[model samples]
Target: MGVDNYKLAMWTFLGSECFFFGSLIGTYMSYRGKSLTGPYPLDVFDPAVTSISTFDLLASSLFMVLAVHYAKAGEINKMLGWVAATMVGGLIFLGFQYYEFSHFVHEGLTLKSNLFGATFYVLTGFHGTHVAVGVLLLGSLAWSAKRGHLANIGETTEVIGLYWHFVDVVWIVIFTLVYLLEYT
Candidate 1:
């Protein structure tokens, strides 16, 4: 398929994912304070740290787009370089996620803690999983680029960038609706 068609398909999939996550987040919002006993979101969440992680994820999107640009131009090395950077960003986000999840669990806010905890953990945890998957995809693409398996680096990079952008947009919503909105 052409790049435009490929992008359309990816976006469609992402649109569906939005609904999936929306339902999860909506459920979490609905049951936010239903837990019998707990440190609530504003009380327990480290908004500062999460904000930094959000920034990191967002920056990765820039690198992703740049990689796509380079690949399209047949600048293989530059594309690979950007892909590697994107993967690093994804890894850093995942590391931050690991720390955050661990901290929450230690604070007695876990998936099984209550309704809020269950919905919150499941939704955000799934997003973290998506980040990990994106990292793997980036790594594999870089590997293929290195080994000469990617005959069209630009198009492949564009496709990956599309997926990466989808991930970033979801985080934007999560950062705003799930975290910041709670405070306001």
Candidate 2:
């Protein structure tokens, strides 16, 4: 009966993320190139920073897998360490997002500017929100482990890992379509 509810939860959340990110992408697509300003994607996007953040999020997924593996091995401390590392990676990505958004706003990409601004910000902003939520979930799990509240470490990590992987998958789409696909 070791079905791992933790992992199960992650799958369920990822299913929802599909629709969530899907809408974001759709909105962005519908509004692209409709900007009435000079601060368009090519004009304002710092692809290099975004590319690095994308890679960091991907790395966090790897660390999350390692954490789950350690959890299954009953290495509680190692599991927690990996979870902490994942959180740090997520934070770094968020920091990058904050900087990117701030830079865009400075360059006149406000949601009120035009359709392009509205869709672009909403889509990316929602993704950022998801990342923030994932960070919270990971942080809570880490805290639970530290406080000895987790009954089945493996199960918990499995669930958290599922969510973590889903987050990474979303970013993959975002980077490919939103960031890199700008030239397309």
Candidate 3:
């Protein structure tokens, strides 16, 4: 058969997501270093912690790839296990984000605190939300696989993997531009 319809739709959705994230990143870049207040990137951003979180997300993408690979091979249990691993990775990334945001707030940086805070929160908050949604989707896939409810496990896994990989790539860009660039 040709490209699966769901995969086609997912690609289209990801195409749109490029523009969505592009805008957020663009805005954040334009407003970078314009905070005009305390709690700047150097002061507030914990690069070491953020790096660990980024690694967690990238590792999840790897697990997602394995899930899809096993799904294509018709190994349902292996696929489910990989999917669960991917979800755990996503959850870990979110946990780091939650801690980072909370620490920023306690240090007096918030969306309303400054231009940096506003754009930073909007960009990264949207990413965190995407990660959360991805985790939920993977969780559902694992649950359905365990219950023997998936009609086409391979296609489902591939489609979700596309989304997961997209999110991971987006985070790479964000991590580079939003976080790493601060030191340059």
Per-candidate clash tally: 1, 3, 0
All candidates in order of TM-score, best leading: 3, 1, 2
| Residue-level error in angstroms, candidate 2, position 64 | 0.6
lDDT of each: 0.87, 0.85, 0.93
42: Cα error in model 3, Å: 0.6
Model 1: per-residue lDDT, tens digit, 1-184?
Answer: 5547767778788889889888988887788778887767876799878988999998999999999998998889998899999999999999999998899899888888777688888888988989999999899999999999977777777887888888898899888877988788
- Which pairs clash in the backbone of model 1? 71-154
The candidate scoring highest on lDDT is 3
lDDT per residue for candidate 2 within 1-184, as digits (tens), equals 5765656666766787788788878888877777776667788889789889988998999999999999989999999999999999989999999999999999988888887778888888887887888899989999998899998888888887887787788778878877788777
Q: Deviation in angstroms for 78 in model 3?
A: 0.8
Candidate 3: where are CA atoms >4 Å away? none
**Higher-scoring candidate on lDDT, 1 or 2:** 1
- Regions of candidate 1 where Cα sits further than 4 Å from its true position: 1-5
State the weakest 10-residue window (summed lDDT) of model 1.
Answer: 1-10
lDDT of 2 at 53: 95
Q: What range of 10 consecutive residues in model 3 has the weakest lDDT sum?
A: 34-43
